[model samples]
Target: MLAQTIVNGLLLGGVYGIATIGFSVVWGVMGIINLAHGAYIMVGAYIAFALNQWFGLDPFLAMPFAMVALFVIGYALQAFLLNPVMHTSLLLTLVVTFGIDLFLIDLFVLFFSSDVRAVHTAYSGSSLEIGPVLISWVRLVAAILSVLVAIASYLFLNRTRTGQAILATALDREAARLMGIYPDRAYGLTAGLAAAVAGAAGCLASTIFPISPTLGISFLGAVFVVTVLGGIGSVAGVIIAGFAYALVQAFAATYLGANYQQIVAFSMFLLILIVRPQGLFGKPFYGES
Candidate 1:
């Protein structure tokens, strides 16, 4: 039982990490705590759901389409709506993003009617038996996809020229601009990439969990903790902190009941904030290699 419990948590950790990476990236790069991030994921899940119903595409196969759509949405948001007041004040940015989140939620509610939905692919409830531990197929697939995406994101930031330019621009706009790298273009691209990751994660997560218009915001607290714990904007940090957070939640759910899960998680979040504010994988700053 204990082994199975641990395995379940491990699988969930990947999803949790993937979900928060978008939130983390936006914060790391744009200094914006995008409340709309959950909405973005919600949008992706709906896109996949629509594709599945209309064209019979597997939810997994719909990931790229969802990602592309979200990238366009995110880019337009940052380029047109956000850039004007981005540097005005932190509170203003927060309020703007919060309004954006609310707007998206309402829009989803209007179109989708806020119904709880899930993607029941061919292998929805099937599981693999590894001795006494039975792992759900959907979970295993989601975990694998999450890991691949996370790794790809890490590589993108480290290896690609555009990524390096983005990192440079985010860390120090003036310095990056002096080197002839445009901050506006980089910022827009960063937001687009962040949303794209969220879209992919949403498609995978829809296979494992229910989808709904309001389902995205419920994750805000947990993902915020994960993002901070993983050292905001660090892919490796999110992976490490995600697994740790999942393990904690899994164990708590088993031993302390589900109600205690959030209590315990938030308690740990406070403890970590007080003890090591920089976070598990947090660095003083990110620079190109």
Candidate 2:
């Protein structure tokens, strides 16, 4: 039973880890908290839901379409609002993102009617058993996809010219500008990429969990907690922390009781913050003033 629970936790963590990476990138490089990230995921899930309901499209296939739509939304948002404030106080950025989150939630509620919905494909509930451990196929696929995306993101950050430019821009905008890299353009691309990843995650989440306009708050909390615990800019750290969080949640849910799961998560977060404010893989300047 324990092993099975651990496996389930690990699978869930893998998806959470990938989804959080998008938040990490936007926060780490752009220095923007992007409070609307969960909303982006929520919107993406809704897009998939719409596609599935209206056109009978498969959830897996609808993901790319949702990703593209979100990419455009992110690009436009950064190019117009966030890019202008990159030079201002961080609090301003935070406020702007918070506003965006509120706007998005209301927008979704207006359009989707605040109904709780979930993708109900036949395979969503099917599982494969290995010994005593039963693994849901959807979760396994999500886990594999999450790991692949994280690895790809890592490679993009470490290997490509544009990627390097983005890193330089994040580390020092002025210096990056001096080197002929346009900070605004880089920021837009980064936001677009982050949005696309969030879209994919949202689509997957729709397949596994109930979707509602209000669920964004809880998901945002989970993703942010994992991101902080792992490190703001570290993809590898996020992956590790995601699994760690999942394990903690699963164990707490099964042993300490589900009612106490939130308390455990928060307690661990508090303990980590007190002991290692920089986080497990966070840098010295994380959440820098």
Candidate 3:
């Protein structure tokens, strides 16, 4: 039972890790607490759904389209809307994002309705048995894809010129600007990349969980806890923390109850904040002390 639970947690954590990477990137790079991050996830899921419904595209195959769509949306939002207030107080930025989040939630509800949906594939119900452990095929694929996404993201950030510029901007915007890196363009690119990652996560999620207009809220909460726990901006740290959190929740749900799972997770989040505000792998950002 313990082994099975561990495996389940690992699978779930992989997906969670992918979902939170975009959130971490946006926060780490732009110092923007994007309350609309979850909205992007929701939009991605919907895109996959629409593609599947209309053209019979596999969720995995439709992910790229979702990514492209969200990337454009994110770039535009940052360039036109968020950039104007980029120099404003953090509180104002937070409020603006919050308003945008609310608007997205309402928009999703109006268009998609509150109905719950899931992507059904031929292998969704299949499972693989190894010794005493059973793993769902759909979840296994999602987990593998999640890890690949993380690796790809890491490579992109380290190898590509644009990615290097992004890293430079994240480290010090003024220094990056001195090096001829346009902070505005980098910021927009960062936002777009984050949205692309979120879209991938949402595509994976559609295969595993039922999605709804309000599902983004729950995902947003989870992302917050994971981002803080893993330390903002640390991709490897996020992956490790994701697995740790999933294990904890899985064990809590198994031993206590479903209701206690979130309670325990949130409690741990609070304790971590009180004890080590820097998080497991977090370093102080530009303004942070």
Candidate 4:
């Protein structure tokens, strides 16, 4: 039972890790809380759902389309909307994002009609058994792909010039400007990339969970908790913290009852705040600190 629980937690954590990476990156790079992140995720899921339903494309194959679409949306948001308020107080920015979130949710309801949709592939219901453990194929694929995405993101942030520039801006905007990095463009690009990652996560999630407008905010608490717990500025942090959070939830559900799962989870968040506020892997900038 314990081993099965652990496997379940790890699998869930892999998906959760991918889902929260963008939120971590955006907050770390731009200092924007991005209440609209959940909206971005929902859009991605819908994109995959549409593709699967209309043309019978696999959600994983449709990932790039969702990423590209979201990249454009995210970049435009920073260029036209967020950049204007770059110097505004954090509270104002928070309100602005909150409003954007509401607008996106409204659009989903208006168009998608709050219908719960899900993507089902031929293999979605299949599972693999290894000795006494059984693993759902969809979840296994999603988890593997999620880890691969995280690794790709890490390499992009570390190996590419554009990524380095984003990191430079994140490290110190003034210093980045001195080095000819345009903070505005960097900010926009960061948002675009973050949204792209979020989109990919949504694609992965569509395969595993039911989709609906109401599910837009489903990841809100989990992402925040994972981001803060894993430390604000790290990719590896999200991956690690994702598994940890999933394990915590699984154990709580198993031992304390499913009802207490979130209560315990949030309690851990509070405890983390009071005890080690910086998080186990917290740093000033991802990879820099």
TM-score of 2: 0.96
Model 1 Cα RMSD, Å?
2.1
Where model 2 places Cα greater than 4 Å from the true spot, the runs are 285-287
Clashes of each: 0, 0, 0, 0
**Tens digit of lDDT per residue, candidate 2, span 107-193?**
999999998998778787799989989999999988888788788888988899988998888888899999999999999999998
**Residue 71's lDDT in candidate 2:** 93
Cα miss at 131, model 3 (Å)? 2.1
TM-score of 3: 0.97
Per-model TM-score versus the true fold: 0.97, 0.96, 0.97, 0.96
Point out the worst 10-residue segment of candidate 2 by lDDT: 280-289
The deviation in Å at residue 243 for candidate 1 is 1.1
lDDT for model 4, please. 0.88
Model 1 whole-model lDDT (C-alpha atoms): 0.87
What's the lDDT for residue 68 in model 2?
A: 96
Instruction: Using lDDT, give the best candidate's number.
Output: 4
The better-scoring model by lDDT among 1 and 4 is 4
**Which sections of candidate 4 miss by over 4 Å?**
285-289
